[model samples]
Target: MNSSLLKNIKTLFKDTFSAEPVIIASPGRINIIGEHTDYNEGFVLPAAIDKGIIAAIGKSEGPDCTAIAIDLKESYRFSLKEVVPVKNGGWRNYVLGVVAEIRNCGKEPGNFSLVFGGDIPSGSGLSSSAALENSLVFGLNELFDLGLSRQEMILISQKAEHHFVGVKCGIMDQFASMFGQKDKALLLDCRDLSSEAFPIDFGDYEILLINSNVKHQLNDSAYNERRAVCEKVAAILNKEALRDVTHEDLLAIEDRISQANLQKCSYVIEENERVLKAVEAIRNNDIKTLGELLFASHHGMQHLYKITCEELDFLVEKARENPYVAGARMMGGGFGGCTINLVKKDKLESYKKLISESYKQQFRKECSFYHVHLSDGTHMIQTTE
Candidate 1:
C-alpha cells in the first residue's frame, strides 16, 4: 500500500463515514508485449503500473450496496439480495457483478459503501476496468473477512466483467492486476493459469504511454468480429484455441481456414512464441533483443491481427524513429488507444515533444502522454493522520 494513498483514504473515510475506512488499491496494467494472444489461450507479459484504482470502503447499514466515484462525480446504489442489471450507463455493473459472482460461488456477499477513483487513464488500454473490479473485490474480502485467495479473487473479478460488462475478454488483465510486483513483469500462461515474474531491468530506459485520445468502444462489433474469426478458425482446425496451433500447423492446414482467419490464427500462434522469447530476454538482461521483439509484435498486430489503426501506427512508427526509443507498439484491444514505448530516460522529454509535434501535424490531434512504473498489486493501507 502506498502511504499517500493511505492518507487520502483516511481523510475520505472521516469525511464520509466519521471513521477511518479500509483503503485498498488495485493496479492497472500495461502489456510489455503480447497482444491478441490471451483469448487464444497464449502467453502475455504485463506489469501493473503505478496508476491504479483506489477504494475506501466500509460496511453500509442497509442491505444495499452503494458506491460513489470521486473522479466521475457519480453515485449509485444497488440491492445485494435482488441484484438487477442497472440501466443508464451503469458503471456500477462492475461492482454489482462482483457481488453476484461471489454469491454464486457459494461465498456470502457483504454490502458496503465504496468511494473510489484512480489515476489510471480510462479506455487507454491500461486495464482500468480490471483495476476497479479487483480493488472492489479485494476491499470487500478484507472488509467482510472473506478468506478468498488472490487466485479466487481474480476469477471472481473476471466473471464480474464478463457477465456484467458483456466483454468476452481473457483473464490476463484481471490476473495481472492481482499478482503484479514492482520491478517485475508477469509472464502469464493463460492456458494453464500459471505465471512467472520476469525482471524488468531496462537500465536508463523508461516505458512511456501515448494516448491518441480516440475512444475505443469495446462494445463495437469490430472486437466481436475478430473474436468470431478466431473462434471460427479454431473450430475449423479442431483445436480448442489458436494456442494449440503453431506457425507450421497453420501452414499445414492453411487451405482449410479462410485467409483472414488464417492471418488471425497465425498471429496468435507466432505471438505466443514471441512472448516466450521476450520473457527469456528479460531474464537474460537483453533489453535490445526484447526491444526487437516489440517491433516484431507491432508488425504482426498491424499486418496480421488487423487491429492497429492509422493513428496508432503513426504514433508507433514515429516513436520507433527516435534514436533513443528501443521499441514501440500499440497496447490494447485496438481501433484506438495508446502505444507503449521504451525510451531512454534522459531523452524522454525530447521524445515526447517530437511525438506530440508529429502526431499533431499528421492527425491534427494532440496526444496524451505519461510515464509509468511497475507497481504492487491490490493491498490495504491503514493510516492515522
Candidate 2:
C-alpha cells in the first residue's frame, strides 16, 4: 500500500466531490509460474503485489455519475439508467462494466462519484485492469450493501472484462487480485476455482520484475490464435479442455495434427505439470528446483508457444547467465512484458544494472525494473468524512 497514492486520492475526491468517500485498495497480480495455461483449465501460481489502484467512491444525488481519473488527468460522466459500453471507452468501460454487471445480477446500484489512479505500469503484465475492475466492484458492493461475496465480486470483475473490455481473458487475473494473501502464492485450479496458498519463503532471494517496455503487434492476434489451437486440439482429443489431455494422449494424436499444433498442446500439458511440481517444490522449500522450472517454462514459451519477442528472450537469457538469479521467465501474454526473476537479495543492484544496460544497448530502448512484495487482495481502507 502506497501512502502517497492514498493521500492523493483522498485529496482528489474531497476537492472534486465535496463528500465523504469509501476508499478501496485493489492490488495488481504477478504469476509466479504457469503462463498461457489458464484458459486450458490448467494450474497457475499467482500472488497479488504491493502495486495497485486506490479508489475513492461515494454515492451521488442523481442519475449521472461522474468519474475522475487522477493519473490520466481526465474526467467522464455516465448515467446509471443507461449502462452501455462505449466504443473505445478505455478505462471508462471498466467502471461501466462493473455497474452494468451489478445491475445484471438483479441489483440496482445508484449513481456514484469516483476518483482513482494507480502506480502499476500499463502493459507491464501486472494485471492493472483486473485491479481496477475489482476496485470498482468492491467499492460499489460496499456503498450499496450489495451483499456480494469475494468470490462473487471476482466473477463480476471477470465478466466486466469480457463484456466491456472485449478481452477474452481467463479468470486467473481477477481471482488472484481478489483472493491474494500476503507472503503467499496461490496454486489455483482454473477448472474448479479452488486454490492452495503456499507460503513464499525465498529466504535470501527476492522477486524482481524487468519490464521490456515494448509491446509487439503480434500480442493480441497471437494470443487468440494460440487459444484457438488449444481448443481445436482439445475437441479433436474428445476432452473438455487441454488440461484433461495427458502427455501420452497428446502423443497419440501427434500424427494427425501439424507439428506446430502438437508443440502448442505439448506446452500447455507440460506447463501444467510444471505448476504441480512447483507447488511441491514450494512445500519442501526447494527454491533451486523452482528456479529450474522457471527456465524450462521459458524454453517452452519461447520455442513451442512462440509468444515471446526478442526483447523478452534477451532479458530472460541475461537472467540465465547471472549466477545470482535463481530463475527467470517471461510473464503474462508474452510478445513483450516483464520477466519475473528470483534473485539473491545481495546481487539485486548489480543484476539490475547489467540487465538494464544490456537491454538498452540491444534494443536501443530503456527497460524498467520493479521490486514487488506479496500483498493482500482488494479491500476497504476506510470511509473518510
Candidate 3:
C-alpha cells in the first residue's frame, strides 16, 4: 500500500468508526499474452503488479456491515443476515458476492465496516475488479478468522465475480492477484488451474503499458458471443473445448465450420500454441522469438478475432518502427485497452515520447502510460504504527 493511501483510509476508518482497521493491499494483474484463452480453458501468462486496491477493514460489534468506497465516494450498508446477492447493487455486488460465497464455505465474516480505494486505473484491463474482490475476501478472512487458504480464497473471489457480479470471467485474474510473486510471471493452465512461475528478466529493457482510454460498450456482449462461438466449434470437432483443437485439426474442419467461426476458433488454437512458444522463448532467452510471437498474437486478434481498435493499432505500429522495441501488442480483452510493450531501458523515454506525440496527432487525445513491475500477491500487512 502507498503510505499516504493507507494513512488516508486508516484516518477515515478511525474518525468514522472510532477503531483501527486491518489494512490490506490486493494487486491488479496484467496478462502478457494468451488473451481471451482463459474462458476457453487454455494457458495464460500473467503477473500481479504494484498498482492495486488497498483497504482498511474491521468487524463491527453487531451484524450490520457498512462500506465506504473512497474512490467512488460512495457509502453503503447492509445486514449480514441478508447477505444474498442483489441485482442492482452495482459495484457492491462484487463485495456482497464474496460474502455469499464465504457463507457457502460455512464461514460468515459477521458485520464489518471498511474504507477502501486504490491507484489501479479502472477499465485499463489490469483486473481492478479482481483486486477489489480479493481485497474484501482477504481482509474478511483475516478479520473473522476464516482460515481460508490462498487457493480457496481465489475460488471464492472468482465465484463472487461470476455468481454475484454476473460477469462469467475466468480464474486468471483472481489467481494472479492472490498467487503472484515479485519479479516472476505465472504460466497458468486454465484447464487444470495449475501454474508455474517463470523468472521475469527483461535485461536492459522494461515492460510498458500504453492505455487507449477508449472502452466500447460492445465489449461484454462481444465477449460472450466469441466464447459461444468457440464452444460451437469445439462441439463440431467433437472436443471438450477449443484447446483440444490443433492447427491441423482446425484446418481439416475448416470446410465444416463457417468462415467467421473458423476465424475465431483458429485464433484460439493458434493463440494457445503461441503462449507455449512464448514460455519456451522466455526459457531460452530468445527475445526475438518472443517478439515475433507477440506480433503474431496481435495479428490473430486483429485479422482473425477482430478486436483491435485504431488507437491500439497506431501505438503498436509506432513501437514496431523503433529498433530497440523488441515487441508490442494489444493486451486484455481488446475492443479497447492497453498495449504491452518491451522497450530497451535506455530507449524507454524516447519510445514513450514518439508514441505519445504521434498518438496525440492521430487520435487528438493524450494516451496514458504505466510503468509496472511484478509484485507479491494478496496478503495482509500491519499498517504503519
Clashes of each: 0, 0, 0
What TM-score would every model get versus the actual structure? 0.94, 0.96, 0.95
Pairs that clash in candidate 3: none
Compared with the true structure, the alpha-carbon lDDT of candidate 3 equals 0.87
Q: Residue by residue across 1-385, what tens digits does model 3's lDDT show?
A: 4777777888899999999898899999989889989988999999999999998899799668999999899998999878777757766988899989999999867789989899877678888889999999999999989999988998999898878876767789999999999989999999998899979787777899999887633225477688888888888889999888887888898888789888888899889999999999988888888888888899899889988889888888888888998998998777887899998999888888988898889989999999999999998877644
lDDT of each: 0.84, 0.90, 0.87
Candidate 1 weakest ten by summed lDDT: 1-10
Pairwise lDDT winner, candidates 1 and 3? 3
- Please write out the lDDT profile of model 2 over residues 203-295, one tens digit for every residue: 788999999997533224578788889999999999999999998998898889999999999999999999999989988889999999999
Task: Choose 2 or 3, whichever is better by lDDT.
Answer: 2
> Arrange candidates by lDDT, highest first: which order?
2, 3, 1
How would the candidate models be sorted by TM-score, starting from the highest?
Answer: 2, 3, 1
lDDT (Cα) of model 1: 0.84
Question: After superposing candidate 1, which stretches have Cα over 4 Å from the reference?
Answer: 1-10, 88-90
lDDT of 3 at 354: 89
Shift of residue 266 alpha carbon in model 1, Å: 1.0
